[model samples]
Target: MEDRKVIIETGWNLDNSYANLPKLFFSKQVPTPVDSPKLIILNDHLAAYLGLNVQSLQKSDGVAVLAGNQIPKGALPIAQAYAGHQFGHFTMLGDGRALLLGEQITPRGDRVDIQLKGSGRTPYSRGGDGKAALGPMLREYIISEAMYALGIPTTRSLAVVTTGESVFREAELPGAVLTRVAASHLRVGTFQYAAEWGTVEELRALADYALKRHFLDGDGTENRYLFLLQEVIKRQAALIAKWQQVGFIHGVMNTDNVTISGETIDYGPCAFMDTYDPATVFSSIDMKGRYAYGNQPYIAGWNLVRFAETLLPLIDDNKEKAAQLAESAIGEFMQLYHSNWLSGMRTKLGIFNEEAEDKILIENLLSIMHKYGADYTNTFRALTFDDFTDMALFDTESFAEWHEKWQERLGRQEESKDSYHELMKSSNPEIIPRNHRVEEALEAAEKKGDYSVMEKLLDVLSNPYAHSNEQAGYVALPEKSTCPYRTFCGT
Candidate 1:
């Protein structure tokens, strides 16, 4: 892990900012080199964002570095240390199969983490081999890109490389590596780790670093940790609101996966809800529905409270006063969350101006959707582009009553009918990463080595707002199943 042992020519505009932190924050870990690495996909658009050349990256030496077979010049790779409340239980955790290779200073002067997932094992691997199967790695690439295209704040996938190796899981699966770009790898669990394991000085150092990286616009005169807490609360509120509007289920909202930078991080066991049910749970491990679609906002609030607990010592020297400040700051979470959710719902429903009855109207529509087992995305698309009466789900007597009320509401808008429908079209996507389609794409690539299917999906997903005939196939309702559709962590 020496900066001197430069093995590849990578003009990444690299700066090892996270690596410069106290050694306790991370352990120097070299990627376990893979055999016969081959580049499967490269996000050229994102490569341009990182100020990198996809042509160079598609070469053999670049593929070697990309597959963890070589380290790039100016890169100081490390496995970050942290702890998290996993499914409501506290545990120490850190990077097991991931390694941060340093930050890429983009053309826009933005610094983003360039990390390799499914790279290899590190001190945090515990008792398992830190290898990743091709299917899951490709899954992250697909869904993460789809999220980015949907205008959600999320980590972007740079590339995926097949390692010509196998990881033994449910069955022997082909191994792969994913290069993930993000605001930073810092998470709520990271602060928890600092509070629990590091000294006060170390925790302060971490907070100062985070402030410099993220909250650069803040004033120095105020309590920076308090400002940090306030910013995180606002971001999480807005983020989860967006998720709910789109019917996305994180499936596991672990403290470790809650990012401090506010970008959606982990895609493990994540899926979008087709049926508009708040009680939807898709993660196979979530038997009790702890992180169901409806529970995300609350779970996020719970995670923020844990984050607030970590900052108590840093918020003030007097412990009681610190607790009060943290409590006051965390208390604003629910209100902020509701306000954000309502605002997003308004846009989706084409409510140009809010009225006292708007929230009730939105709730009533959702109630009807849930009652009739209506398709969530299509319902909005129908309202945006077609009359609700044309859709059979809205053909009921109750729907007609609700439709009349909705028309009355729309009549009160200051904006023209065309303008408001335009707003709705932008807010509501024509396509989402539907579960059945995603599974089919993954199966084609993993089983038959046909990546064209995934590529086509990504192509259509790259523009979720646009109306296109090609996307019609992707927008079709999934075939009904006898049981629930489930996703796994795959580790």
Candidate 2:
């Protein structure tokens, strides 16, 4: 094979808009390299989408480029600065363990930020090593790819590289780096950074840039800041609704994790629930369950309010007017979230219309699921194939009664029963990244150098709605012994 290592030039012209701001607004620095970098995972499809040659990227030379041992040409690496409310408490944070390796404008005219996770520490490291553990890297790869397959907006993983080093969390774990591609990495916390530092000009500049990049239609509006806030609210509402529909809990809804681009950005300590429960929390750090399964919508609204506060200065010079405008924008979050969430719930239940009793039917089914500790994904998946004969899966006679009512509701719809069945089949996935299955795959990979299990799980997750007779075991929930397999923050 020809030499795959290619040196690209650093396109280092500052987008003066951000750099022109005061120095306190950001600390400019490049990514620090690791020793003995080796490629662990490569996402060829994503590379080709970005106009990169996949064949070259699969070679050892491309491994070095992705591992940050050698910087790619036209890449200018810098750690972004931002502040966030971590678990409901405001705290200053930045790209402590990651570096943004500049932006790539795809052939399709989409601007995607290429970032290196687990690169050596920067000013924002905060007394900790900036290394990432291999387990978390694989977990993110699995879950992020699953999210993408499910048709949700998210920051996609481009590649994963193992550092010939170990990180100490509970034990010595292998280190890895994940190349993450995002629509934009700007977060609500980015604005908070400027607002806290009293840099109004920088805040306005950041808002204007975000508006141009994500909400182009808001240009020249009298209340442009208000328009931006409303736009973000709409996107976030839809994003979180999808999370709920898929039984995915982010486990960390911190302000820093809330991207202005509205993509599911950070995949830390996130998991898909095996059984439905509103109080589900898998993050070891989330002891209080602040970002629990049921609280996601409320938490999203709370985060948007913080984003609104940062934009108050630009909303209007009058503080009172700004607060009023911001409040109006924030108020819309709940309604918009409900609209999307309810729509998704209806689809899950095979309900095609928005009826008054639809909410009651959905809530009652959930109540039964929680009461019986029934598997969330499987229960919904079974409903798609149900001919009203598998009452035992509902786990209670009471639920069986509710199923009859659901069947009656379906009878009222004008569409053919086959069409409703197909709709539910598509909306309710046959497989999800079950906690036990993911843990099982990770254990095998870490202990035996075997990735076969992970590969199998990925194959099943890719076609989540497809019925595969050979892979029936993949859709089954874990037994009682594996019921509480919680995920950890692979720090």
lDDT of every predicted structure (CA atoms)? 0.91, 0.82
Model 2 per-residue lDDT tens digits across residues 34-61: 7777776677778777877666666666
Which parts of model 1 have CA positions greater than 4 angstroms off? Answer: 1-10, 389-391
- Highest-lDDT candidate: 1
For model 1, state the Cα shift of residue 285 in Å.
Answer: 0.5
Residue-wise C-alpha lDDT for candidate 1, range 195-311, written one tens digit per residue: 999999999889989989999865574788999999999999999999999999988899999999999988889999998999999999999999999999999999999999999
Q: Could you tell me the lDDT of residue 414 within candidate 1?
A: 85
182 in model 2: Cα distance from truth in Å? 0.5
State the weakest 10-residue window (summed lDDT) of model 2: 9-18
TM-scores of all models? Answer: 0.97, 0.94
